[model samples]
Target: MPLTKEDVAGIADYARIALTPEELDEMTAYMNDAIDLLEPIRQYDLEGVEPTFHPIGDLSNVMAGDVPDTSVRALPLDAALRNAGSSRDRCFRVPSILGDQGGDR
Candidate 1:
């Protein structure tokens, strides 16, 4: 079923958002607009047509022959290191972005 203004407000609440009344009205309109835009798809004659995730026809393996190729130098070491936000001696340094904290769920 299509969503309502109350539905949007509930979602925002779940996300812990502090939305103003104007924002709620805007979100409701946007949601309704999106639902209205998809109305034509419901009217489409898709009978006897196989639903495909990809728009293109069935793909066959088109891989090239496995051959040893010479490695091309992409960039100089100094430039590559400089491009990184932080780096150590010849290695790029990065903060721990992922992985669970030291505890079992």
Candidate 2:
């Protein structure tokens, strides 16, 4: 069934969105057009076809597995903190973006 303006308005209401009359009408047309485009797929005959979760089927990791290199050593804590503008308790300190609720981190 085609989407009506009222249906779109209801959806907008459910989503806590306030749409103008013109926007509601446009959204209704857009939703109906999308549904119409997919309507042709309903005519396909796939009685024995299994539903696929992944389009490419079962795929293993395509990237190379992680292999630790003993040649490369981790940077010392003192060296790592040397260039830091601010640090506290062996960790780099950054200004909290979540306001005073996050406290002084």
Candidate 3:
């Protein structure tokens, strides 16, 4: 799991990022050290450990206090589309995510 400079460089390229030589060396060392720390963690023998999946110790008020407001209300289908930039068959129309050339499908 010792990551090399070439591995770091390839990662940067795949992520569409540019990194200086100094940054590349730093990233490689940091990642290799992280992997070394994780290597010992994977060897733990947890055959009878009960799962405590939730992180919350107490179910206290985790959300903001509700406040009354006149601004929020359910809107009729047609009323909701009043200010839409564009629509087709009463549905909002947006540009395709894969661009004008069409998707791989």
Candidate 4:
């Protein structure tokens, strides 16, 4: 059935939207047009068509194989920390924004 202005307005009100009169009329027309377009598809005879995951038959996944990359090697602790501008107790040391927030520096 085609949607009326009242239907559109009710739906907008239920959805907690504040639509102007022009917008409500436009939405009503849009909904009615959509219903008209879908009216022809209501008489299809696909009684035995099996439910399908993919629309095309026998489609394989295009994903790359899940394997750990071995080309890049892990860095040693010292090597990782070598480029740090400042580090303390094997961790980064940044300038304290909040003075004595945690404890005595």
lDDT top scorer:
2
Model 4: lowest-lDDT 10 consecutive positions:
96-105
**TM-score for all models, in order of appearance:** 0.46, 0.52, 0.41, 0.46
- The reply for model 3, stretches above 4 Å from the true place, is 45-105
Put down candidate 3 lDDT per residue, 26-85, tens digits, no spaces. 899898888888987779998997767567755667877677565888577788788898
How many backbone clashes can be found in candidate 4?
0
- TM-score result, candidate 4: 0.46
Quantify all predictions' global Cα lDDT against the true fold.
Answer: 0.82, 0.88, 0.81, 0.83
Clashing pairs in 4: none
Q: Model 3: which residue pairs collide?
A: none
Candidate 1: worst-modelled 10 consecutive residues by lDDT: 96-105
Task: Give me the overall lDDT of model 2.
Answer: 0.88
Q: Name the runs in model 2 displaced over 4 angstroms.
A: 68-105
- Candidate 1 residues 29-55, lDDT tens each? 888899999999999898999888766
Worst 10 residues of 2 by lDDT: 96-105
Candidate 1 lDDT (Cα, 0 to 1)? 0.82
Total backbone collisions for each predicted model: 0, 0, 0, 0
